[model samples]
Target: MESPIYLDNNATTPLAAEVVDAMAEAMRAGYANPASQHEAGRRARRVVEAARERIVELLGGQTGGRQPDRLIFTSGGTEANNLAMFGLARMAEDRYDGPHHLIASPVEHPSVARAADALACENWQVDHLEVDAQGVVELASLENLITDRTRLVTTMWGNNETGVLQPVAPLASLAASRGAMLHTDAVQAVGKIDVHFGNSQASSLAFTAHKFHGPLGIGGLLVRGDTQLAPQLFGGFQQAGLRPGTESVVLVAGLRTALELWHTERSARLQHLTSLRDRFEQQICAELPCAQVVAAGAERLPHTSNIAFRGVDRQALFLALDMAEVACSTGSACASGSSEPSGVLLAMGCSDEVVRGSLRFSFGAQTTPPEVAEAARRISKACKHLERQKHR
Candidate 1:
C-alpha cells in the first residue's frame, strides 16, 4: 500500500522537527514555572519572555521608549480572540458612557463570531459587515458602520474555509480614523502572509503556534502600545497580569523555534506552497470539470484550496476520500461533525448546492509534489465513484 496523503493543514499543522527538538531541550533545562521566585523560575521566565519579545519583533511590532507593544500569551487563538473581544471592550467601560458599539464580519471564525454574539447579548450594539460572494467583507459598509459609539472593529486576516485574505490594513485605517481600534484574528495569516502588525495599524492581533508548524496550546495576542487591555483572566502577575498563569517554557521553546525556522525561509515556503496549491487545483479542475474553486477571484492563503463539486454531496465525497486515504475537510475543523452547511459559505451567498459540495484542501510545509499529484487523482476517482453510486 502507498503512504497516505495528508492535506488538512489549515485545521492544524504537524510540529516541525526543530520545534520538537527545542521543546524537548526546554523541558530539560527550563521546566520550572515562570511565576516562581527562585533562580530556576527566573530561567524559565527568561525562556518565556524570549519567545514573547521575539514574537513582537517577528510580527513587525515595536518595543521600548515611552510605550511598546505587548504580547500576552494564551492557550491558543481561541482564548486570545476571546480576550481581545472582552478585554478591549471592557477596558474602556468605566470611562466611556452609554452602550458599547462593535463592528465585525459575518464570516469570522466561531471564536470571534461567538464572542460578538456574547457581546450582543449584553446589550452592546454589534453590527456585522456583509461579505461578498467570495467571502471578502465589504469595506464600504465599514465607513458607514463606524459612529461615535464604536469601540472595536474585528475581522479575520485570512479565512479558514475559503482561504480568502481580508482587507485588514485598510479596515484598520478606517477604524482608526473613527477612534475605533481594529483586532485581527491572524491565526491563519501570520505565517502564510506578510503580516506586519505595525504596518497594519491594528491595535490587537491573535495568532497561535500550531497554525504555523509550532506546538499546540501556546499562542499570543499582540496589543499595540497605549492601548489598555483589561484583564480577561484573574490570577497572578504573569503576562503583565493580563492573562495571568504559570507560563509553559517548553511550549514557548517550540514556538520560538518554529518562528525562527519560518524566518529562515519565509519567501521560499510561500512560493512552494503556492506552487503546490496551484498544481493541485489545476489537476483537480482539469480531471473533474464538475469542480470549481471557491473564492477563485480573491487573493488567498498559499496553502489552502477550497473547491466545490457541482453535483456531489460534500460529506459523501469526504468519506470516500478518507477511505481512499486522501485527507481533506468539508469546512472549518472547528465546526466539524455538525452536519449543517458551512456558515461561512452561507454568509458569502453560496447556493445550497455549492455550500454542500465544497471541500477544503490545505497543504503544509512538508507537502510534496508527488503527494499533491496522488491526492488530486485520488479525489477525482473518489468523486467519480460516488457519482456512479448515486446513479445506481
Candidate 2:
C-alpha cells in the first residue's frame, strides 16, 4: 500500500531526524535532575542552560534590554499560555486598586479564551475583541476598548485554524501606550513564521516544540525583561518558581535542535511551502469551483489553507477523504470531537453552510509537490463523489 499524504501539519508535525538523535543522546548522557548540586546534576544543569540560550538565540537574541529575557519551560504551549495569561492577570490583581480588565481576540485558541473566561469568573472585565470577515481584529475598536484599568492584552500571533496572521505588533504598541502589558501566544507562528522577541513589544510570548517538528510535552514562555509574572506552579526553585518542575533534558535538547534547523533554513522553507500552498489551492479551486478559501485576502501562513466547500457536510466529506487515504481537519486539533461549527468562522460572519463545510490543509517542511498533487486529486475525487450522493 502507498503511504498516505499527511497535510494536517497545523495540528502537529512529525519530529525531525536530528531532533530525535539529539533527544536520545541527552536521555543517555544528561539524565540527572538539573537542580541537584552534585557533579552529575551540574552537568545536567549545564545542558539545560545551554538549551535555554539556544532558544533565546532562536527568538532573535535578547535585544529588548540590557538584561537577558526569561524562558520558562512548561508541559507545552497550553501551560505556557496559561502561565502568561493567568499568571499576569493574577499579578495585576495584586497590584491594581479596583476591578482589573483583560482583552483577547475573538478567534484565540481555547487555551487563551478559556483563561480569559476563568479571569471573568473572578469579577474581572474580559472583552472578546471583534474581528472582521477575514478574521483580523479591528484595531480602532481595540484602541477604544482600552482603559486605565486594562492590565494585560492577550492575543495569538497566528490563528491556528485559518492561518491568518494577527496584528500582534501594532496591538503590542497600542497596549504599551496604554500602560497595559501584552502577551502573544506564538505557538503556531514561531518556527513557521518570522517571530522575534527582540522586535516585538509584547511583555511575554509562548510557543511549543511539537508545532515545529520537535518533541511534544516541551514548550516555553519568554518573559521580557522585568515583566512581572506571578508564579503559576509552586514547588521548588526551578524557573524562578514561575514554572516549577524537574526539567526534561531530552525534550529540551530536541527543542534546541529543531529550532536551530528552523532558524537556519527559514527562508528556503517559507518559499517552498508557499509554492506548494499556492499550487494546492489552484488545483482544489479548479476542481471545485464553488469552494471558497477562508481568509484568502488576508496574509496567512505559507503552509496552511482553509477551504470551504459549499453544499457539503464536512463530517461526511472528511470521512470520505479519510477512506480515500487523504488527511485533513475541520478546525483546531484541540477542538476536535465537537459536532459544532468553528467559532472562528462564525465570528467572521460566515453562514452555517460555509462554517460546517470548511476544512484545514496544512503543509510541512518535508511536504513535496507530488504529495500535494496526489492529495488534491484524492480530495477532488472524494468531494465529487460526496456531492453526487447528496444530489441523489
Candidate 3:
C-alpha cells in the first residue's frame, strides 16, 4: 500500500519527531499531577511553566513594562475559543450595566460562530460582521455594528477554510477605541504566520498545538494580564480557576517544542510551503481552466489553497481523490461529514454552485515538491473524471 499524500494540514498536522520525543520523555519522567505538592509534582509543575514561557515568547507575550500574559491550557482549540468567547462575554456581563453585545466575523470557525449564536439565544445581542467578496471582513460594516452596548468583538486571525488573513489588528484597535474587548481565534494562524499577540492588540487569543505539528488534546489561550475571563471550570486552583484541571506536562512539553521549531524554522518552512502551494495552484489551473481560486486577490497563508472546480460535485471529487490516495478536505474539518455547502464560501458571497464545488488543500512543513506534483496530478484526474460522470 502506498502512502497517501496528505494535503489537509489546515485540519491537523502530523506530529514532529522532536515534539513526539519531548512528550514521550515528559510522560516517562514527569507523571505526577501538576497540582500536587510532592517532588514529582514539582517537576511536572516546572515542565508546565517552562512550556508556558516558551509559548509566551513565541507569541511575543513578554515585553517591556508589561507582565507576561497568562496562558490557560485547554483540551484543544475548540475549548480555548469557547473560553475566550463565552468567558469574555460572561465577564463583560458581570462588569458592565447594559445590554451585552458581542460581534464576530461571518467566516469565523464554528466554535466562535456557535458561541456567538448561543449568546444571542441567551438575550445577548450578537452581530456578525459582513465580509467582502474576497472573504475579507468589511471594515465599514464592523464600525457600523459597534455600539455603546457592544462589549466584545471576537474575530479569527486567519480563516481555517479559505486561509485568508483577517485584519485583526485594525479590528482590535477599533474595538479598543469603542471600549470593547477583542479576542481572536488564532488557531490556524499562530505558527503558520507571524503572530505577535502583543502587537495584535487582542485581549485574548487561542491556538492549538496540533495545528503546528505537536501533540493533540492540548492547546492554550493567552489572555492579557489585565483581561479577565470568568472561570469556566471550577474545581482546582489550576490556571487561576479559569480552566481548572490537571495539567498534562507531556502535551505541554510537546507544544513547547513545536512552538520552538516553528519559531526557529518559520522562514525556511514558509518558503517551502509557498513554493508547493504556488506550483500546485498553477498546475491545477492549467489542468482545469474553469476552476476558480477562492480569495485569489486576498492575502492568504502560504500553505493553503481553496479552489472551486466549476460544474463538478465536490463530494465526488473528494471521493475520487481519496481513491487516488490523496487526502484533502472540502472545507473546515469541523464541518466534515456534513452535506452542507461551505459556510465560509457562502459568507464570501460565492454562488451556491461554486460553494458546493470548492475544496481546501493545505500543505505543511514536511510536504515536498514531489508530493505537490502528485497531489496536483491526482486532483486534476479526479476532477476530470468527476466532471465526465456529472455530464453522464
Candidate 4:
C-alpha cells in the first residue's frame, strides 16, 4: 500500500537523513550537560555554540560587525514568540511613558496574535495592521497605526496558510523610526525563502527546525546582541538567563545538520518546490473550476498553496482528502482542531464562502512531482464531489 502524500510542510517536516545521522552521532558521543565544568560538558557547549553561530550566519544575520545578533534557543516557535513579546516588553518597562502600544496584523500566528491579546488584557494598547484582498499587510496601515507609544510591532514574514509575504523590511524601518521594536515569526519563511536578519531589521525573529526537515522540540529566536530582553523563565544563567534551561545537544546537532543541508541546496530546493507548487495548483484548477488559489497574486513562499473551493465545506474536504490518503490543513498547525474559520482569511476580508472552503497544501523539499500530481487529483475529486453534494 502507498503511504499518504504529506502536503503539510508548513506544519512540520519529516526528519532528514543528514539530521538523523547528526543526532545519532551526538547521542553516541554521550554529551554531558552544557552547564557543567567538565571537559565533556565543554564539548557539548561547543556544539551548541557552533550551531548557534552557524545558524545566524546561514540566515544572513549579523556576525563579524558590531552589534552582531544573538540566538536564544527555545522549545519551538511558540516559546520563542512569547519570549520576544513578553521579554522585550518587560525589558522596556523602565522606559514606558504613556499607554504602551503594540502593532500587529490580524493575520499573525496564534502565538503572536494571542500574545497581543494577553497584552491588551493588561491595558496595553494593541492595534492591528490591515491587509488587502490578497492577504498582504498594507504598509500604509502600519504608518497610521504605529505611534510613539508603540513599543513593539509583531508580524509573520511568510503567512503559514496563504503564504503571503509581508512587507517586513520596510515595516521594520517604519517601526524603528517610531522607536518600536519589531518581531517576526519567520517559521514559514526561513527554509522556503532567503531570510536576512540584518537586512530584515526585525528586532527579533523566530524559527523552528521541525518546519525545515529537522528535529522537533527546538527552535531559535534571533535578536540584536545589544537588545536587553528580560528573562521570562527564572533559573541558572544559561542563555544569559533569558531562556534558562538545559540545552538539548542532540536536537541542536540535528538542527545544525538540517540547516547545513538547506544552505548547500537552497537554490535547488526553491526551484523544485516552486515547480511542485505550480504543478499542483495547475492540476487542481484545470479540473476543478470552483477551486481558486488564494493570494496567488501576492509574493509567497514556494512551498505553500491555499485553495478555496466554492460551495465545498473545508471540513468535508479535509475529511475527504484524509480518506483519499492525502494530508493538508485549514491553517496554522498550532491552531488545529478549532472549528473557527481561518483568522488569516478573515483578516484578509475573504467572503464567508471563501473562508469556509479554503485549505492549505504546503509542499516539502522532499516532495516529488508525482506526489503533487496524485495529491491534486485526489483533491479535485474530493472537492468536486463535495461541491456537487452541496448543490444537491
TM-score of each candidate structure, all chains considered together: 0.98, 0.98, 0.97, 0.98
lDDT measured at residue 92 in model 4 versus the true structure, 0 to 100? 71
lDDT of each: 0.90, 0.89, 0.89, 0.90
Off by over 4 Å in 2: 61-66
> Lowest summed lDDT over 10 consecutive residues: which window, candidate 3?
60-69
Residue 54 of candidate 3: its Cα lDDT? 74
Predicted candidate 2: what Cα RMSD to the true structure? 1.2
Model 4 TM-score, 2 decimals: 0.98
Per-residue lDDT of candidate 4, residues 161-240 (tens digit): 99899999999999999998999999999877899998998899999999999999999999987777888899789988
Candidate 1 all-Cα RMSD:
1.1
Inter-residue clash pairs, candidate 3: none
**Candidate 3 ranges with C-alpha deviation above 4 Å:** 63-67
- Write one digit per residue (lDDT tens) for candidate 2, span 246-317: 998998899999999998899999999999999999999999975889999999989889999988889998
Error of 2 at 43 (Å): 0.8
